[model samples]
Target: MKKLLIPFKISLLTVLFCVCLTNAGQRRLGTSAANGLVIQQIILKGKVLSAVNNEPLAGATVRTEIASIKTDQKGNFTVITKKNKGTFTVTYLGYQTKEIQHDISTSQYYTIKLDPQQNTLDETVVIAYGQTTKRFNTGSVGRVTAAEISRQSVANPIAALQGRISGVEITQQSGRTGANFNVLIRGRSSIANGNEPLYLIDGVPWLSAGISKASSVGSQSPFNSINPSDIESVEVLKDADATAIFGSRGANGVILISTKKGKQGKTEVGLNAYTGISQVGHTMPLMNTQEYIEMRAQAFVNDKISPTSVNAPDLTLYDQQRYTNWKKNLIGNTAHLSDLQLNLSGGSDKTQFRISGAYRMEENVYPGDEADKRASAQLNLDHRSENEKFRISFTSSFSDYKNNILPTDLTEGIYTAPNLLPYEDNGSLSWSENGSAVYNNPLAATLRSYRTKTQNLVSNLNANYSITKHIAIRLNAGYTTIATDEANVYPLSSFIPNNSRISGESTFANSDFNSWIVEPQLTYNRSFGDHKLEMLLGSSWQEEKSSGRVIFAVRLQTKLDTLG
Candidate 1:
């Protein structure tokens, strides 16, 4: 009996010791056991102000690891933190960010001051020949930065300037993927010829304005070939100041675009990808079958004409119970949008290079195998001599896109008798009803297929050599070429078999545009007291050529842009 009791007591003692250890572990708290870092919650107050004038910034935001807070009207804020020694950042609308790290072991209040970004008067603005400050530039100019353009997130770069720039009016002509945009700078300037501003992409004159049918659904702009992601900046030169460099071509205005270049840094690769869906926001309500019948009958009575099978086929010949909502059937589906952009950039002080590739797809709202896809690539290279007196740069871009949709208008179908059906029970067109030929079928036009493929390539090379510190000579050259192929097919199902003479028809078209330019310039600059004098001597030679071929075929007629 004594031996059994002794063994039980020892076991009880060991169990008691384990419980005591567990309780002590739970009570011990100060540093995290996982990372061994001290975490003490604390709250502090701060003030945000401008560094130069010491004025309060009413809308500054202060962000820390634990909390984000904004300054009050008096530039005061309170923030909660997790550490006694902490770092935080402060930001304002037009001010440079200010960061502060403080050992708050003893202090209660912190202060932060931020500096304003460079004033607009001192900001650099790109001009016709070179860059100048906004204050010193004599001509009217408007500029948009890469950050602003990226925020728009539009496939067409022209759409980015819709409400951004004043005096420049941009209107979208279509809702298709590669839609056209009419851009008028300072209103209309021409009567017969095109009123388009000269467009330059990295010193290369582009064949974007007044393009062919392959470029857009119903318009002539071809700005889609230029990817918005590759642009570094856009400068709009308005008035006659730019005409000195480009002659009469620049009489209206000049839109100069600069692409992104490699920076002097370590090698870096970046990727941008996005996908989304779109649908019609709102649709108009149309009359139903009963209402449409009453309206048609009233129209004939008002015109003092009797309704019959020949005069009013929809009311007398078509099925009385049939109903068709043309708008919903023809243009009610969802569209898909996706894009991917990848780029590699790196270099040294003496030489730098950048390369980028992009692929984008946009689906149509029409219920068919219709979509637009584009693939593009760009490369840029820059080099400089050891003395920094001689420099050269080359830029090139290639783009190819295919569109399989036509601008077919279905407006007539919406107004047609709602009791009319476009097809029969056997999946064939319903062209006749009650011995009368029916022309209310909207699918007749949609059956015709239209496809187009376009390719564009642009290249530019610029070189500069300094004979002396005060004088330099430069040479600029560039070329742009575009090729397009289009095909349209019309089927017999689109027409009434008994009344129409055409059976089937088709058309094929090929168009090409080639243009080149060269400019050699000499510049001299010197400063006298507080004034500077500059002289420019330059000459420009440009040439453009365009050609096209078309083929039309007919069986009786065989197949189908602008809308109804």
Candidate 2:
């Protein structure tokens, strides 16, 4: 029994010794493996600049496996990583991202020049409801940047788009100042109704149709009220996919106009002024005195009319060697245009603002009191909370325009006989008492007064609240008001004995239009694995009201004429 106990004790002690030895070996192996997993950390310094211009890019992101940093205003960045050799990435807006694999132990300083992506595929375009990149957009959309719009000397904003956009045809109906233009996208869609595309300014519908009830001497476009200098970009939606979001209003297509906004930068002030001259491209030469006389003689012989007939002009008066070129006399040779604009813009991280004022004047080619004068002002503001969870923006514009129009049809002046004189030796309008058909004095139309004044105010407010990282609530409200006043005064001298309807007639019209809109929407965006899901649920309410009155009085009852 004593011998068996001794053997059992020896076996137990041996087992314990073997266990201790195994634990020591395992601990040493664990320590070595832990040491192998440790990595050597190093400090890296870098700078980012634009490859095209070599301009320092501030706020550029530099990321590595264990460290991330942004460049300062001087485009200098510093980062510490756990690897001596690893790839680092640099990213910036409007620039191509770059990646560099380096051994920090060998080189701690790096100068990265990021190339600019000028390809249109990466450009961002404005769409119906939001903005999208050209690469991901599946719709047919045309974009006209501010640079393109300002490349030409254009009085109307729509005219600037002529010959610039595909599938768009712009035709000027007349050469007169403030004349209407026909803009057709994808051709005419409706024969019974208007084919004009819907116009939106900063996501708010604008009144493209003339709201005035006054009688106009020629066609006028409501777009004239908006100053072209205030526009930043114009986007035209042509295909069904591009216009579908607008629903029924998009049936005729859509034009989205974006105005200038403040950017996050230092305060900037800009002034622009330009003056130009306009003249008729071509002129028709009228017949001289000798030519007129010969033509009249030939006409009489062809008609078999006796030269002594009453219908024939008196030989003594017609024989006078005098001639007048009515075309040159009525339409003049040159017109003048001038524009001046002043703008101020600036912003910080949390707030931004822009203010602009402009004045434009255009003189008529027909001389006299025919001209168009306009004044406009715009204000835009934006604010964001510290965490960017709450954001609000406001935009407003005001415009006042006055147009002095020709009182008579200029076409009639073009066809006036070369032998006829507009004024007599007594400084009064000339007239003939002959039984032959008589024509009104062409000069009277130039002297008669017809004027139109339009005033418009457009304003919009937008607010957004981020309920979560993937969900947001937004509200938009807008209001627009337009008022027009028109007047026409015909003096007694403009009247003809045969035409009694023009006896000192005066006409006046006043109109007012107001519109308001409210929209509330909730947006949800999330990603599952490699797929992304997005949704927009919204509702909109809009209201418009218009009121107008017109009055016409023949002859003045009192010295003072008032509109009722």
Candidate 3:
């Protein structure tokens, strides 16, 4: 019995020694008891860049014919490929295909550079609001470069987007000064709800003017006062995937405007200028001298009045020379436009800044009217700590608009009273000795309408900090304010003949809004031989408040812009 027990004890000791030796060997292989890293997969991480500029090109496609993946929004791609031997292809439209051998253990993720394959129509379009690789994008996104608008001499940004995109439609409301046009991304989706796409300028939302459709002309809100000249690119986000981030506001898609910002280089200055003429596309068909006479004769017959009852006995002379030419006389020749812009951008790793200013003046298609001027100034600054863990940026802008009264008045007058005719006698505007409602003149109403002036100020700050390799925090706050003053005059003809003959009304309104956005996120990443596991947890909150006040002053003594 003693011998048998001795043998069993020896066997147990032998097994324990072998177990310790195996663990030591495994330690040398750089693995724990669980063998977490020995799986048949691994992670690949790298950037896809432009061959010509070496800039990160977002939306490049990376895949093995059997397996596929896409780059992140920042032009970086991370994928888990099988450990088996195979080839991976990186291809982008307008760029040559790049192929490399894949080995999870020995090869690093590729930093692929694609050369321009100009022959094929394979080009990846980077939309402003969001990005999509041409291969996977199911919806249409329109791309318009800054150069195109500069060539067309477009004064408004939305005007530049027209004709360039297939589905977008633009309608000019009133050719009124300070009239920023409206854009429909795909088509009208709602009957009452506002379908205008949300506008995002350089990552921050450029909130709408907040004037609900319920606001009338006298109470209309000013257009968003951003300068089109400072934009680097405009991308119309057209699909559900592109706009889902904005949720409610994105029901109509979004318009993303990326402003020119400083790069890591020396300060550079760019100047742009252009001039053009705009002519009336069409004229309203109105009475010539003969038509005016005939129409007046018919009116006399319709009203059962005798030719002798007319105040001016020489009705023939009035019809031959004066009243018929009133339409032509009130209108003018082609309108003219001129625009000038200047920009400066540059900075180092620690500090960067961009500054720009632009001025524009134009006479619209409508006669008797012109836009005196529109101007904007913008500035942006960014600073980063040496380690790049913390970054802060400030952006501020100012805009002013001056709208003249003439053209707006003509448009309103013609459309509002198409039947009103000026009585002409001896080639001069004829006023009835005794004012008659039938001969009511619209010129006085045109002369007394409102002139609008507006000023806007916008500023924002953004900061981000990196806690570790895979975790970060960000905070942003912004403020926007707009002040507008308008003066409108309605002469005797506009109101009841005896109602406020010196008729005029002036209104002043101002709106102020403030918003804050805060977000904190944690990212976790691990790597097997050919598999990558990444996890992200994040939360974001935003709050906004707006207030406005309006005042009206009536009884202006003069037709000028100045108040009584």
TM-score for each prediction?
0.78, 0.76, 0.64
CA lDDT, every model vs. true structure: 0.81, 0.80, 0.65
lDDT of 1 by residue, 94-159 (tens): 899888886777785888889988988998888888889988999889899889998876777787
Q: Count the backbone clashes (under 3 Å) in each candidate.
A: 7, 0, 10
Q: Whose lDDT is higher: candidate 1's or candidate 3's?
A: 1
Query: Which RMSD values do the candidates have, in order?
Result: 12.8, 16.1, 18.8
The lowest-lDDT stretch of 10 consecutive residues in candidate 3 is 212-221
Q: For this target, which candidate reaches the highest lDDT against the unseen true structure?
A: 1
How well is each residue in 1-564 modelled by candidate 2, as lDDT tens digits? 998999999999999999788766655443212454734456788889999888899999999887789999989998877676888999999889999887855898999999986888877789866778788788888888888877777767898899888999988666767877788889999998888888888877877665435556456677788988889999999887555667878887889898888888999999999999887667667677677778877888899976753565533344346677777778865788899999999999899999999999998778575688899999999999999999999999999998886635575687666676667778788765234445566777766787889998989899999999999999989998888898887777777755334367778988888989898989998999988788889888888898889998785444343333
lDDT per residue for candidate 3 within 1-564, as digits (tens), equals 999999999999999999999877765554336544543344567889998998887888888644578777778987666545677888888788899787766766678888987541244455532344555566666767777766666556777777888788977655544454667878899988877788766555666543422124422324435677777778777886565556777778877776666677899998988888866567767655556567777888898877752453435323244333444534445678888889898999799999999898877544456455788999999999999999998888899877654423354444322233454546433354333333545455444555556677777777778888766666655666556555444444444344324554545555555555554555565678887565656665666777667676666455563442
Flag clash pairs in model 3. 41-530, 41-531, 42-529, 42-530, 42-531, 93-122, 93-123, 94-122, 369-407, 448-489
Question: Which regions in candidate 2 have their CA more than 4 angstroms from the true location?
Answer: 1-110, 241-243, 299-320, 407-412, 433-437, 499-502, 527-532, 555-564
Model 3 residue 201 CA deviation (Å) reads 2.0
TM-score of 1: 0.78
Question: Model 3: residues >4 Å from true position, as ranges?
Answer: 1-140, 209-224, 282-287, 291-323, 364-370, 384-391, 406-409, 412-430, 433-438, 468-470, 491-496, 499-508, 519-537, 553-564
